[model samples]
Target: MLKKQVSSAIIIVLCLFLFPTIISANTNEQLELYSEAAILIDAQSGQVLYEKNSQEKLPPASITKIATAIYAIENGNLDDIVTVSENARNAEGTKVYLEAGEQVPLLKLVQGLLINSGNDAGVAIAEHLSGSVDEFVVDFNRYLEEVIGVENTHFTNPHGLYDPDHVTTAEDMAKITQYAMKNETFREIFSTKELPWDGETWDTTLINHHVMVRDGSYEGVTGGKNGFVTEAGFTLVTTANQENISLIAVTMKTMYDNQVYEDTTKLFNYGFQHYETDTIDMNSQFVDSEDNQYKTVENIYYTKKIGEIVEEDVTTSGKLVIKGEDGRKLVEKKLELVTNKEKEKQQIKNETIYQTDDNREQHLRIIIPISLIISFLIAAFFFKQTRKI
Candidate 1:
């Protein structure tokens, strides 16, 4: 009775420990805001921390210039002099007042588009890169597909002037910005508080536009682009870092500027408050021996140390299972004796190989049937004994 009671107590304790981990792994909230779409992401892990209608397509306004700048920096010579064309000077909306035939370097034009939100700079950069604005849009769309991994985003022009068909989602914008941020030149240009061009320095007067950058909660408030139009309302993308925790917060079509900033601030705060970088040792014997069948599986060997930084509330716990191609569990691992410290150490030792289980394959040779002889002998002996009785 004592043994049974002790087993029941252990079972109850295991259930108590596992229930919260399961719940934390799936816990999330979908906030409703005036913005058409929004998303907060961990910059390092590319993990979506929070989202609100993030996939809804909407006008991206000047935010489109980010992709344009990336293309220019990658393809064009920054020192090359690009002569302003008739179309570039006549480009509608915010302009840097460049006259036709006026010569400017590729670098200045990119800075103009990013800093002053100049629509004319977008046209100039497009014309210089692809010989025409139309061609640039095609290239931009292709990059959006191939490099940015954005499905719903389309660019009609270098400047995000309102086109009925030109649209992108908050999630896509986050993804694009994340990609663009990888470029050293793009990051330098986007984050610049003051830029000098045409013998005049353009200071960013719109400091209050992105609250996270101005508020100083983050150590390196790198730089991000902001946008707004009658159709798009208000949009902003901001990147901030606190210690090793870097985050990107995007808001679109917010009813008020304060609302967007407030929402984004909340997201940044939530990430820092709940989430942390945890170093798990993946080489520990606990994780290696987690599945007793690891030794029995052919062609499968322990690989590398793997660690994941997750929310404090979310427990990093999973059961080891030998699964077939169809995802049916063939064997379950029983962790008879394992310590949390050993598990954590194993996670850090080799993280890459165990991060994904997709390549784990079952070998046919391991499934040979040889138990029939023993079963037959046991049955014959049992029958003879019964006859004697």
Candidate 2:
């Protein structure tokens, strides 16, 4: 009895040490962030790993240029030369100093707009793309809503100058960054630390304003952007990749620049250290109460803490939901019920019965002739017996 008790204790200890979900659930706690709004998401799956007031509408400041840059890249001809308009030169706040009538490629304007946070470059790009900034606003907001799937974001200008109505959420900003990062041109420009700049009145190297990427402050830093306005405070977005996993972190309305960076770093660390992608194979099957089998048509990946228990629930309508231990949904996949081809084949076989009218008629004829022969033989025997008597 003593030996058996010791063995059971050892087994319990081993189980406690082996499972990651059990360890994570007991040890992990949500990190506190300094920013008013922040979110961390898996770049591949778009799953929110952590958030604090992520959907709160706040002025995005100059980070609004992220949308402007990507829009220009997708819509405007980068090689086309743009003649700087008077409106562009007179634009206020951080600028590369474009002189009136200065001829520059749209690509250079984009680089200046993103790298230097130049309000002038944004206007110029806007004018070149859509004839005027007013016209550009219409298309910009349309793209944000229709193409990018950001419902809460609104933009009034090409540069993130403070506007009362211009606002975005941390979650929405993260989504925009995730979408923008897919473009090679945007990624190259966004990740660039410094580039040679030759302007009509000014000549210098344009350096990226975001410290995490430009200064190599963080490991695996891929790209980043920063924005600041008196009304908006400090806002920052950064993307990092490690061990084949990519993440996006966005912090908005922090009191200080350091706070934004600190908050962003904390968000990234929490995601990388505690969470991982769990994949559900499409070929896996589950049976319903009625014995109908269902399967996913494509593989699904979701982010969750290591060693956390994930539950699967399938509704009769074929919605497959993956939930965390606390019953919060992590991923929802649409599944298709398996088709029972064998049952159909069996039904078809049963319907194709071999009995025909001719076969039934032949059987009836054989039975009648045999019956007549037997009767006749019986009658003959009876008659012979009577004669003997």
Candidate 3:
């Protein structure tokens, strides 16, 4: 039992000391980015692969429509015909040019909002769904915070016009796009290159504003959105998939039109070149020196640099801490105790017998010596007593 206790304590200490800190960068090389705020992340694991001022809040411009589109898809009835209002007709910036009182499906407006960067379409969708732009913005912010897990975003309008309060961070926008891309309807709309527009005033093709998606600039470009305002600079969000790994890159407040794209490409190349996903299967079991079995309850995927060593530390309380090559923690999971009923029972019986045998040997060593010592002491005591008498 003493040996067993010492072994368990050593195991715990080794686990804690093996990886003292988390490794953030897989490589020492850094990408020079022109954007004020930028981030690249593994879409599946939500692990930040690279970042520069990712939490800096700036104008998101038309990329705000990405949030608007997904919110509409989830909350509004896409098939319902929305009657265009005067407010929607006169909405400023790029537009699909909807005439007042024209009947169009909510889904079509969403398509136009994303594909064309149509501010008018954004206004129409907002008004139709929430009855007013102000109310729609309230719900939009709520969804961004509570549903999408973005904290630094605040929207004053659905169209991403230059309102002082309308702003978001590159990381937050990336998170929003990541969540939106999960929906089938939103993904279809986000990646569309062009669609036929049959509006009363604008009867032409609505082409995607994102050059990367339209031109296939990259091999696996799935969807992208770019935005601009005098205050927000140039903001871009792009997602690409290669070799089964999906990545999201968001850049904000780049001074030049092309800088956002350049920063995005640099980030993407860095992630694809250096990082990889390692999956931990839930059913995989570990056998310790004592033959104790342990398994996780669910599967987890971790992103690490290529050729990095991944290690696992299982504690006595059943917590499994996973570390990357740089001694950074990648994931922690609670392991479940697995029992092989017959095998465990037999092992317990064997352990009990072994302990009993050891105890008997210990008793022989201790009892014999103590009995002889007692006999000597009693003989000495009686001799002393007789002399005194």
Question: Best candidate per TM-score, number?
Answer: 2
Instruction: Go through the candidates in order and give the C-alpha RMSD of each one to the true structure.
Output: 16.3, 5.8, 14.1
Model 3's alpha-carbon lDDT is 0.87
Model 1 misses residue 124 by how many Å? 0.2
Candidate 3 residue lDDT tens string, 1-389: 99999999999998777654323333656788898889998987788888899898888898999999999999999999999999999999999989999999999999999999999999999899889999998888898899999999999999899998888898899899989998999989888998999878668988888888999998788999989888889988999998847899999887899898888888888888888887888788865445567887788778887777898887666667889876988877777878545578899999999999999999999999999999999999999999999
Q: Is candidate 1 or candidate 2 better by TM-score?
A: 2
Say which prediction, candidate 2 or candidate 3, comes out ahead on TM-score: 2
How high is each candidate's TM-score?
0.65, 0.80, 0.77
For model 1, the stretches where C-alpha displacement exceeds 4 angstroms are 1-32, 199-220, 278-389
| Residue 205 Cα positional deviation in candidate 3, in Å, after optimal superposition | 1.5
The segments of candidate 3 whose C-alpha lies over 4 angstroms from its true place after superposition are 1-26, 281-298, 315-319, 333-389
Q: Give the candidates in order of lDDT, highest first.
A: 2, 3, 1
List the candidate numbers ranked by TM-score, top first.
2, 3, 1
What lDDT does candidate 3 reach at residue 163?
A: 92
Q: Assess each prediction's global lDDT (C-alpha) against the native.
A: 0.71, 0.89, 0.87
Residue-level lDDT of model 2, residues 314-384, one tens digit each, is 77667788888777798988888795555767777766554465577889999999999999999999999
